[model samples]
Target chain A: MTATLAIGPYNQSERPALEESFNAHVVADPSEAAGMDPAARSTIKAIAYKGHLPFGGAEMDLFPNLGLVANYGVGYDAIDVDAANARNIRVTNTPDVLNDDVADLAIAMWISQGREMRQAEAWVRDGKWASDGAYRLNRKVSGGKVGIMGMGRIGRDIADRLAAFKTDVHYHARSEKQTPGWTYHADPVALANAVDFLFVALVGGSATEKYVSKEVIAALGKDGVVINISRGSTIDEDALLDALEIGAIAGAGLDVFVGEPDLNPRFLALDNVVLQPHQGSGTVETRAAMAKLQRDNVAAHLAGGDLLTPVN
Target chain B: MTATLAIGPYNQSERPALEESFNAHVVADPSEAAGMDPAARSTIKAIAYKGHLPFGGAEMDLFPNLGLVANYGVGYDAIDVDAANARNIRVTNTPDVLNDDVADLAIAMWISQGREMRQAEAWVRDGKWASDGAYRLNRKVSGGKVGIMGMGRIGRDIADRLAAFKTDVHYHARSEKQTPGWTYHADPVALANAVDFLFVALVGGSATEKYVSKEVIAALGKDGVVINISRGSTIDEDALLDALEIGAIAGAGLDVFVGEPDLNPRFLALDNVVLQPHQGSGTVETRAAMAKLQRDNVAAHLAGGDLLTPVN
Candidate 1:
């Protein structure tokens, strides 16, 4: 039997399981994926993919027998679904498994920003607390109004968690959801204006790129904060940086960033913001579950069964 | 008329309010009190004390006409209550007002520790994320068992918040109350052993000193995390440091410490711990409420009205 091809920088522990289950051949990314012997590539029927590095029809054309692409995360924006659909390639993703982890992080970042947890921790570590009597008072987070940009699964999870924080959940979606007590705004700018915190939980990819526009950030005025757990593409980076620099918005607690890992250096200089290295769903339990689900989908494809979590 | 004496490092915003409310005489601390004239000392009938500085018989006796010690925080451990009782001096504390802020910090710290928020933020801030890949996977916080050491107002609030995070709430108090669906541990060690996270919210005083003892710390095995939002005296700090150093416990997120401001050097050296500068109630809204409550108690006393939140 030929092998299942795995791509992207997977954890070392995941490699063994991938190989043992499907006789998988792993490579760094698409760059190394090219120029594989035609015979080896032709035999590969399923691809277990990780990371968002565009896997369009051009990449799919290399593997003649490829029937399925199992993505390692909730978002499959990197996979050109339209291209795959034309070529009759099925797509599966790992979702719901990471919702708890992502929501936990979103709430953590929001609370950290409001309470000055970052600077306060530094004061304790750097002996400033010993010298200075008390840290300066910060504004409260609980009992504030929050605007969620999207009302999808992850957005709902974040809203549910923040609901426990005693925040009024106002939201913007394509249309209003059946969220009884939560106020819905048709326009994103209106939602931003109504809330003290703007929590971005929109889907990633080109369609929603810069969805959290300059107007929305502006509506979230001098006392408003922005907390993004969704993809960085959802927000306009330049506008956010300008607002943060000029104090047009109060502060931010960001996880995902545009061109992440190599994000804008301007974010590093801001004293008011709390920045994290895109670890929203980066937890041991959630990652393991995501990996297992990804493999399960691949296994289903090999066995000619239905995909576990098919995106398309 | 004689003025109400305010002591400890009150905020700049609070100073004016204090002066406006009672013609308040502000002093840094007790160190500055010893050399005051007898007439001035006698005039200070009520001391709006704000810190844990052993306001005992000696300090109370300094003011010959001292009738009240209104504490600026929920904990009145600093006030020698027995001594105050003997001298017929009433004690009042600012409570309920700070519960939301304290609980929010506890949950924030717990989630931050579980998700490695501190280290992850550092990875972004220090340009390590650009150099490295994603932050190393951390354990998930939601769906874990959390043991709250006390079931008081603040503890209840923490439990309520964590409940929303999908945690199973197990708590230990003097006697089990009417909390349905939550496990009640009679002993601290059992509570520590039963949960992955041990949250300290016990009342602060000699009775509860070292309540989270060496044995309890030991019971909270290698994977256990400790989150303290209560007073420093609730837990044995030395045992906590030793456990964190040797990995007897996974990590700690501490808001309070013994001899706070100047905590043990051992804590500063540990990377596994998240040290906060006692900012549980340090927010603009909450602190203002606390100050107003403290003043309200003083005002009630002057009006010969009922004390709002009296201790003794």
Candidate 2:
């Protein structure tokens, strides 16, 4: 069995691992194929790309050549999954493996932003302490309210972590859940109104798109915070900006966005928000685990077994 | 019997609860005496200040009329204890009442900073989804090393929180402690080298001052984080900057500073550090509890019983 592999801009451990598992010829870079002649391009049977795909830009044409394009993460919005589905090409994503890391990050943001840890450290780094007064305290976290949107694996994981802190857990999902110790609300607004901190863990696409809008933002009145770990489309940027500008909400911690990297200019101007390059499941251990799963997924697809995380 | 009373900056519910226990007058603004005329200054016999002393800037003439000064919180740096002692004035501070809140904040900072929660949330709020690609995974918290500079009550509380997380706990103190599940090192440099995260919970006075210096920072090396819930003097500012700039130490979460509100400018530039406004015991419950303790301390002193938290 002949296997042709197109390599994406990955962190490099994938190449040797996949090669060891199958007779694979690796295309080291996906961009190099743009200049390759038709005969050269015809030689490759399938490809995998990593790192980041430029937003609102052309989908790298490498997907058409592959029988399976196994993404190393849960979010595959960057890849044209619909286009691949139209062509009957199999699109796979590695999920459930990165839940702990994501949940850890979520809880961390809630505490850092709420407690003003960044600002606290600045005082020591500055020389004013040699001449001045006592340290000022920030907000509280232990008995605060925590609301999770889209209560899947990562959301549930975050709830479990919060349990140790004794925080009250509330979640908003499409339908009510029978999960104990969880107060479920069918609407996001009610959840927003009740929670001091709101988390987004819902999936992307039409159903969850624009779910956390102006109404939800309004519900999360003053001193409320929004944390989004799902797709950027889950939140309405303009609505968030309006809430932030007027101080209707305390602050926000976001991991996903509708149009990232070239993020909304409004977020950059606000000091109340914590910013990062979209790297939620971007840990070394988790990424390696994700890559292994992607490999298993591709091999299974080839072996006539069902895909681990099928898009359909 | 002729009686005199002194209370710290506590609210009505906290300090006034001792009305029947002793003759106490709880002043609303103890710092206002700084600007008073001679007659008004002479009228008040005692005071209670909470972070109200313009310590390093303008010293208030609080001693001439004051027979005793009772501080609200554990730290009495705001009160001129030497000056009060010279005038035969007794100084008292509420110490043990604040251990739990400080400890809770320390653990919160540890988990939040380690996981990079702030950066993750910012990615989502910025609308990175429509314009960009994948989510980045952050660092983990469980099984990491947690070092303590001061193995006092708050430090012990932090150690207690880590038990559930399964973190390896290490502490550096002047003397060895019999704390369970804890490894104590007599040398700060040795402890810094052995741990990934260090918590500062030492005393505020002379002996423990400037304890964490360039040598200790270097010992920790890159990827090490220090959290200061103790006095700002525990860490040497210049050394911390050098460590942070060169990546010798990964980051720090500071609640206390050497100069305070007039914090150092260097910390403002770094992305790795987390800052707070010196609020270890700043929660509503903790503050209220501290206020009640302060009232009780003053009442006990007036009643001729044992002082709650007296300076030896």
Candidate 3:
């Protein structure tokens, strides 16, 4: 009688909660739905999914009775929303709950890049501090101009944190929004030109694919650094790598990358960049909250009520 | 005739300015004074001092005509002010110039420790994210209560930055001063007990030696963390190392340490701490500002005008 199908990898805490709450049929991935009995697969009214693999119209055909896809993370780029809309299926994502964690990571990377936290740690741990007199001085971060590529919830949160550090906030969005004395640029290149740091926080999907193009990255001068907590596809990967390699841009503080967890090998060799493993929202508290929100959406769908955070 | 003697290590930029401004005689250490001709040592009226080696009453007595000790850094714990006062020797420190950089390091460490930034970076670089799955989740940092163990310029700066992150700020100072709705605790132990994080920004000197006593560190329960960007004398090293070893507290984000550059071997072994090589005020812009300030003080002293930032 189970109507819920929990797909993709779930943490220890999440697995138990998913099993107990929904009497869910669990699988490691979306493709494994084919392995389920024909009768059971058709019974799935809602799916609790977490991963970056695609969920398109063909995948939706596997579940004839599928009504909702409740994603466990904030970004639902993996879920083809147009496909879901065409199939009359609802989509829900866990947002706002993860804004603080992502924003914290963005700010952390920004400061770490300027202060050289990784190299500093390595110097201390490897006994270089004892052998060498003092670590080399790097650039100062505070009292600089910063541009946020997106002025969404997560972008605004990062801007607020940087504002405390006395950075001048500028941004480029589709249109101007009300803000406290922050400059807005309609063109991404102009926004990049205006600031010493360009932080990418745009949404994922085709319309915004390669949104941070070569021109935008090139506009950031040799002293400029880029920090990205958004999707990898939002950036022109080759352009970024080229810029980082040749010192076209000063550096990058990246939590996401193209084809990640198997990112560009060039990134591994670079010393100028601060690379994080796409952990913008990877906090115990925030993850649990996201899981709960996803489950709540499934419960609401099963109960024939409206989805809590509906995308379509 | 050269009236100034530049002591300890000076970066390339600082060295030329120090030499040009005062026609200063240079020595690697104060002990090298013994090697100088007696007449030259006696004629040194001002010393542009750097490094953490003590400038006690005995060291002060070496340069018989010494009138001022212009320190390169803000924390003048290395200079024996009481001894300077006894000899009518003035002391000047480059203060306020490096506060933002120090405060930024404190916040950077605070966020880095919580986010497991070191591990996250390693996960990507080592190809573990592809081999294994996602990096393990860590605790959230923002929207929590944070405590400041001092209310000095740097302490206030750190609190202001944390406030923008939506953290409830609580502080310990000699007495409460004007703050933006931050709760004050007169007792250091109470401050430790009240918040999830305690940032030590106390000044260094015998008066505040081991100010963050064993009792105060013990008060921070298992979930609490400590961040120190101040002088190494503020905390008992043995107590901190012991607590870290036994997991008495969660972790520490430390920049300064006792006998730093030659820190306790125990700190290198501990995985719970984010160890930095005492680079709190080591940014290029800030360091240049500090060097300029120190040189300005020396120039003023030589000209028989008011010292820029005199201590005694």
Q: Please give the CA lDDT of all the candidate structures.
A: 0.91, 0.69, 0.92
Q: Please give the lDDT score for candidate 2.
A: 0.69
Task: Give TM-score values for chain A, per-prediction.
Answer: 0.98, 0.86, 0.99
Chain A vs. native, model 2, TM-score: 0.86
CA deviation > 4 Å runs, candidate 1: A1-3
Of the pair 1 and 2, which is ahead by lDDT? 1
User: Per-residue CA lDDT of candidate 2, range B106-183, in tens?
Assistant: 776776666654454444555553445444545666667888887777777677766545578899887998888589
* lDDT (Cα, tens digit) per residue for candidate 1, span A139-161: 79999999899999898988988
lDDT of 3 by residue, B1-312 (tens): 689999989989989988888899888888886678888989899999998988889998888999999999989999999999999999999989999999999998999999999988998898999999799999899999899998999999999999999999999999998999999999999999899899999999998889999998899978889999998889988998888899999999999989888999998888889999999999999999999999999999889999989887
DockQ of 2: 0.28
Interface RMSD of each: 0.8, 4.4, 0.6
Please name the candidate that would achieve the greatest DockQ relative to the true structure.
3
Q: Which structure is stronger by TM-score: 1 or 2? A: 1
TM-score rank order: 3, 1, 2
Q: How do the predictions measure up, each by TM-score?
A: 0.98, 0.73, 0.98
Q: What fnat does each of the candidate structures reach?
A: 0.93, 0.43, 0.91
DockQ of 3: 0.90
The lowest-lDDT stretch of 10 consecutive residues in candidate 2 chain B is: B54-63
